[model samples]
Structures are given as C-alpha cells and as structure tokens.
Target: MFRRTFWFTSGVAAGVWATTKVNRKLKQLTPENLAVTAANKAIEAGHRLKDRAVGFALDVRDNMVQREAELGDALGLNAPVADRALPPPRRYAAIENRTGPEHVEGPAHQKNPYNRNEDH
Candidate 1:
C-alpha cells in the first residue's frame, strides 16, 4: 500500500510537470500568437502617432488665428472707418528722402530716386 501511494503521487507530479512543459513549448512555437502580439503593439503605436499629429495640427491652427488677430489689431484693419465720409487717400512720400546710392527714378517722375518703373 505504501509503494502504491508513492507511485501514484509521483505519477501525478510527473504528469503535471509534463503538461506544463508541453504547454510552454507549444506557446513558444506558436507564430500566430507572436504575430498577433506584434500587430497589437503596432496598432497602439500608430494610434499614439495619430494623436500627436492631431494635437500638433490643432496647436498650429490656433497659433495662426491668434497671430492674424494680433496683426489685424496692429494694422487698424479690424473694422471699417466709423464715419460715413470717406477719409482722404493716404499720400506716400517720395523715395528721394533717403538720398542714398540706390536712389532711382519712379514711374510718376516725382523725384523718386528708387526709379521703380511702373510702366512695365
């Protein structure tokens, strides 16, 4: 009876060990499982990249809008003139104010030393 009980317990332990080893070996040899794991990792990486790209695009768009608003405010182009009567057209000064070597004649012949010929 003692020998039988010892053999039974040893057999059960061996069976359990063999089953565990076989399961481990089978898992190691399974290409489909590895591929599935790799695919899941790639999908997660792609999602992270897409999320970062969307965030960067939104930031750029917001910055562009803010810059445009600031430029419009600085240039006084945000709104139309308040009075109905149109203001006189702005008269640009002649380019001869510099009196440098780069001075040239303008199209209007108004002492334009820059000589930017508009007839072209």
Candidate 2:
C-alpha cells in the first residue's frame, strides 16, 4: 500500500539522520578533537578579556585627563593665551648665598666630611 511505503521511507530517513548526528558528536568528543576545541574556546575567551581590559584602561585614562583639566580650570591655571605676562622670577631661600654676615654658615657641618670630592 502507498501509506505503508511512505512510513517505511520516513523511518529510514529518521534513523539515518540520528546516526549522522551521533557520529559527529562522537568525533568531537574524541581526545584530540576535544582538546583542540577547548584550546580554541580558551583563545576566544582570552581575546575577549583583553579587548575589555583595553577598553577599561582607555576609559580610565580619558577620565583622568578630563579630571585634571577640570582641576586646572578650578584652580585658575588655565590662563587665557592673551594674558601672557611672564611671572616674576622666584627666589628660593635655600638657593640664595648665605655667606653674608646676616647668614653665616660657620662650620660644624658646612662642608660634609663624607664628601668624596673634598676627600680626594
């Protein structure tokens, strides 16, 4: 009968499909193939992690620069280009000569005894 023939064909097709799927799965589960698959997956994950870390670092650097700009503006360091007056030269107390009578460096430790230049 036509009905019996159709069912027989369908059953055979299903069995063949199932067998092919199982064979493919078994092949993938074999030691060498499984190791390769795992390694490939690990490489993919590492790439994704590296991309995320790079993005995070870039974001942090941008934020840091932006914050520094904000602080400079708040502290009035961002002077306009037109107001270009040179600041008065600064005099550091330590750098000034103190050999004058007002500030004598009379000697206990004036010249370090440990100085190899003087020793030589």
Candidate 3:
C-alpha cells in the first residue's frame, strides 16, 4: 500500500511540473509578448543605423578637412571651402514647350551658320 501511494504521488507531481512548464512557454509565446520583443529590436536597429550614419558623416568631414587645399585647388575654389555655405537648391521653371526652355533654337552648327547642311 505504501508503494502504490508513493507511485501515485510521483505521478501527480510529474503532471503538475509538466503543466507549469507548458503554461510558462505559452505565456512567453503570446502575441503581445512577441510584438513587444519585435518593437524593441526595431528600435535598437534604428538607433544603430543613426549612429552609423553620424559616424560616416564625421569620417567624411575629417577626410575633407585633411584634403581641403587639394580639393579646393581641383575645384577652383580660392576662398576657404569649409567656411562657404552650400548654395540653395536650384529652382527650375516649368517647361512650356515640347523642346523645353533649355533647348536653344539657334543655328544647328555654331561654327558654320551659313552651311546649313554642315555636320553638327
């Protein structure tokens, strides 16, 4: 009778342990928990991306500062390049014709205006 009682108690304990473990797993895998985890990861990735972009900009600025004179000479900038503010974005007028405003209606060949059939 003692052996049967021991076996029964052990079976009950095993069942309880399994129930607790399954409940814990189910709680962890709930939709709310998963969404929260995903959101946290996304926020972390965004922060990392911003950090990398800032670092890249700093590196570019450093390289430009080191090669300021060479770059200025190549680009024909006589004054201090870093001090100069960037020019405002160019505003383009609306195209009113099929040829557009940029298309110059002039002689096809500027070199030889009289030669109409000149290879332009």
Q: Which candidate gets the maximum lDDT versus the true structure? A: 2
> With candidate 2 superimposed using the best TM-score fit, by how many Å does residue 12's alpha carbon deviate from the native?
1.2
Write model 1 residue lDDT over 1-120, tens digit each, in one string.
999999999999999999999999899679998898899999999999999999999999999999999998897777667733677999865534556634455764455344555444
On residues 1-120, what C-alpha lDDT tens digit does candidate 3 reach at each position?
999999999999999999999999999899999999899999999999999999999999999887997887788786777877899999865434545433555676233345333444
The parts of candidate 1 lying over 4 Å away from their true place are: 1-29, 80-119
Order of candidates by TM-score, top first? 2, 1, 3
Deviation from native of the Cα of residue 13 in model 1, angstroms = 7.3
Give the higher-TM-score candidate: 2 or 3.
2
- In model 3, how large is the Cα lDDT of residue 29? 99
Model 3 score (lDDT): 0.82
lDDT of 1 at 120: 42
| Best-performing candidate as measured by TM-score | 2
**CA lDDT, every prediction?**
0.83, 0.85, 0.82
RMSD of each: 9.3, 6.7, 14.0
- At residue 90, what lDDT does model 2 achieve? 95
Candidate number with the higher lDDT (2 or 3): 2
Clashes of 2: 0
Superposition TM-score, candidate 3 onto the true structure: 0.45
Question: Where does candidate 2 stray beyond 4 Å?
Answer: 81-120
